[model samples]
Target: MPAARLPVYDAGPPCVSRAVDAFVRMGMAGVTFGAFMGSYDAVKEGYKGTGRALFVAKSAARNSLGWGMFGGAYMGLNCGLEALRRKRDWVNASAAGAITGAMVASTRSRSGIRVFGTAALFSSIATASEYLRPVQYPPTGL
Candidate 1:
C-alpha cells in the first residue's frame, strides 16, 4: 500500500513587504534625480568651495525622504485595497493616490487643501498613468 502526498503551496510576499521594496526603489531614484539637479544648479551658480557639496547633499537628502514616504504610502494603500477587494484595477490606484495625497497634504500646511487639492491631484495623476499603462493578460494554461 502507498501513502498519498499532499501538495504544498507558496504564496508571494506580503503587501507591505512589496510596498517597502517600492519605497526603496523610488527613494533611490529620487535621491539620484535630486542630486543631479542640485549639482547642476549649484555648479551653474558658480559657488566655489565646500558649499557646493552641501547644497547637493541637502537636496538629495530631502528628495530621498519625500519620495520614500510617497512610494511607501502609495504602494501600501494600493496593495491593501487590492488585497481587500481581491481585484487588480485602476480604482485601487486612484484611491491609493488620493489617500497618499491626503496624508502628504495633512503633514504639510493647508488642511483645507488636503482632500480637494492634493488628493484630487494625485487621484487624477494616478488615473491617467493607470489608463496609459499597457494592459496585461494572463496566460491561458496558467
Candidate 2:
C-alpha cells in the first residue's frame, strides 16, 4: 500500500498580503485624519470657498501618500525581521515597529529626545496590544 501525502503550503504570499493590508489601512487612517484636520482649520478660519475644499483634498492626498510610505517601510521591516528570525512573536514585531518609528521621527526632527520618545511610545503601544490580543490554539484532528 502507498502512503498518503499531505499538500504543502507556502507562507510567502500570506506575509505579502498582510503587508499590503497594513499599508492600505494606515494610508486610509492618515487620509481621514488629514481631511478632518484640514476641515477643522478651515472652519476655524471661517473660510467658505472652493479653494478651501481644494486645500482639504490636497492635504488628505498628501497625508495618504506619506502614511502609505511609512506603513510600507514599517511592515517591510517587521516581516523581513520575522522571516529572518523564523519566529512570529510580539516582542520582535514591537521592536521593528519602534525602530521604524524612530527612523521616521529622526528624519522630521533634529532632536534626539523627540526621536527616542516617539520610539518608546510606539514600542509601548505595540507591547500593550500584544498583551491584549487573544490567544488561539490550533485545532486538533479528532
Candidate 3:
C-alpha cells in the first residue's frame, strides 16, 4: 500500500522566522480585554514597576496557544538540527532565548513574554540535547 511506503521527510532546522512569527501573534493577542485585565492587575501590584515583570509576563504568554506552540516547535526543531550537527546546546538555547526575549520585549504584557520565553528556552534545550545523542537504527531495504 502507498500508505505503507510513505517516506519520512526531514525538514531542515526551523529558522528565526517561525519563532518570531509566533511571538508576534502572541503579542497581538495581549490586546484582548482578558489580557488587558490581567496585565492591569499585574501592573497594579507593582509587578511591572520592579524587575519582577518577567514573572508576570510569563503568565500572559500562556493565553496564546497557537503562538506558544509555534514558538515551541521552532525552538525544538532548531535544537534538534543543531544537535544533529553536533554543535553545543547553548548555541541553540541562546538563539531560542533571544527569540523569546524579542517576543517578550515587543509585547505589552510581561506574562505573555515570560511564558513564551520559558517555552522557547526549554524546547531549545530539550531538542538540542535529544538530537545530539542519536541512536543508530539499521537501514531497512525497501
Candidate 4:
C-alpha cells in the first residue's frame, strides 16, 4: 500500500500586501495616540471648542505622518537586516522603533530626557511584544 500525502496549500497575500496592512495598522495606532495626547494637551492649555478640535486634528495628522514613516523604516531595516543575517530578530525592529520614537519626541520637546525616555519606552514595548508573540508548532502525525 502507498503512503498518504499531506495536501499543500498556496501562500497567502504578496509581500507588498502584507507591508501595506502593517503600515495601515501602525498609522491607526499613531492617530489614536495623537488624538488622546493632543486632546489632553489642549485641555491643559485651556483650549475651547473649535480650538480643541483643530488641535486634535493637526496632532493626529502629524502623528500619522510620523508613524507611517516609522513603520516604513522599521520594516525596511528589519527586512534588510534579515537578508544580511539570514535570520529574523527583534533587535533591528526595536532599534528602528526607538530611533523613530526619539525623533517624534524631539519634535514635541527639546528635552534630552524626554527623547531618551520615549526611545526607551518604545523599544521596551517592541521587545515585550516580540517576547509575547505566539509560537507556531508543526503538526505531528498521530
Candidate 5:
C-alpha cells in the first residue's frame, strides 16, 4: 500500500507569524538606534583638535556623518539578516539600533549617559509601536 499522506499544519496562520515577526523586527530596531548613537559618540571623541574652529567643524561633521552612517548600517544589517535568516527585518533592525545606541551611550560622560539612556527609553517605545503596528508585507513564513 502507498504511504499515507501526512497533514501539514499552517504554523498558526500568517497573521500570527507576521505579528511575531514584527515584534522581532521591533527589537532589532532598538538595537540599531542604540548602536548608532554609541558609534556617533565614539567618532566625536576620536578627534584631537583643541582649536575652536576645528573642534566645531569636527563636531558638526561627526554628527551628520554619524546619522547617515548609522541609518545605512541599520538598514544593511537588518536586510542582510532578513535575507539570510529568513526572518522579519524590522525587529532585527530595531535591535541593531538599540545596540548601537547603547554602545554610543556607554562611551560618554555621566551627562551623556543620562542623555543616551533617555534616548534609548524613547526609542524602545517607538520600536515597540513599530512592532504592534508593523508595516505590512507579504507573509514569508517567518
Candidate 6:
C-alpha cells in the first residue's frame, strides 16, 4: 500500500545563487550560439574580405554578450518571482519568460504587437517546458 503522506523536499530559500548559476550556464550557451552564427555569417560572404576572421570574431562577441544579458535578465526575473510568490512552479517560469521576452523585444521596437507577440511566445515555451520537466520525488529515508 502507498503511504498516506508525502515527504517534502527542502530546496532552501530563494537566493542570488540560483540566478547567478543560471546566468553562467545560459551565458555559455549564448557563447556557443554566437560562435556558430558568426561563422555562418562570415561563410555566407564567400570569404572575400581581408578582415573576414576579425569580422567573425566581433560578431560572435557581440551576439554572445547580447544573449548572455538576456539569460541574466530572464533568470533574475524568475528568481524574483519565485521568492515573491513563495512557490517554485511553472507559474513563476511562465511569468518570468513573458516579462523577459517583452523587455527584450522592447529594446528594439516599442510596438505593442511585437512585445505582446514575443511575450506570448516566451510564456508558452516556458509553460511547456515546465510541464514537460520530470517530477522531483523526495529523497528516500533509507
Candidate 4 lDDT (Cα, 0 to 1): 0.70
Per-prediction TM-score: 0.76, 0.78, 0.28, 0.59, 0.39, 0.79
Those runs of model 4 whose alpha carbons end farther than 4 Å from true positions after fitting are 1-18, 90-128, 135-142
Q: Compute the lDDT of residue 122 as modeled in candidate 1.
A: 94
Give me the runs in candidate 2 sitting further than 4 Å from their true place.
1-14, 133-142
Q: What are the per-model numbers of colliding residue pairs?
A: 0, 0, 12, 0, 39, 0
Best by TM-score: 6
Candidate numbers, best lDDT first, in rank order = 1, 6, 2, 4, 5, 3
Candidate 4 lDDT over residue span 1-142, tens digit each: 9644323232223335545656777789889989999999999989999999999999998888778767765555544554455444677557766876787788799999999999899877866765675432112232
Q: Give the clash total for candidate 1.
A: 0
Cα lDDT of model 5 by residue, 53-79, tens digit: 455544455555555544554445544
> What RMSD, rounded to one decimal, does every model reach?
6.7, 6.0, 12.1, 7.8, 11.8, 6.1
Angstrom error of the Cα, residue 82, model 4: value is 1.6
Taken over the whole model, the C-alpha lDDT of each candidate is 0.80, 0.74, 0.52, 0.70, 0.52, 0.75
Candidate 6, which ten residues in sequence have the lowest lDDT sum? 133-142
Please write out the lDDT profile of model 2 over residues 44-79, one tens digit for every residue.
878789978987898898888889877777777767
Cα TM-score of candidate 1 = 0.76
**Residue range 1-142, candidate 3, lDDT tens digits:** 4223212233322445545654565556643433666567776776745544554455555555545654555555555555465454556655655565455444545676566766566556645654664332112232
Order of the predicted models by TM-score, top scorer first: 6, 2, 1, 4, 5, 3
- Estimate, for each residue in 1-142, the C-alpha lDDT of model 1 and write its tens digit: 8544323222234777868987898899889988999899899998667999998998898989889989888878887886677666999989998988888887886668555699999998987877875453211234
Kindly give the stretch of ten consecutive residues in candidate 3 with the minimal lDDT sum. Answer: 133-142
Q: Give per-residue lDDT, candidate 5, residue 4.
A: 44
Better of 3 and 4 by TM-score: 4
> Alpha carbon lDDT of residue 139, candidate 2?
20
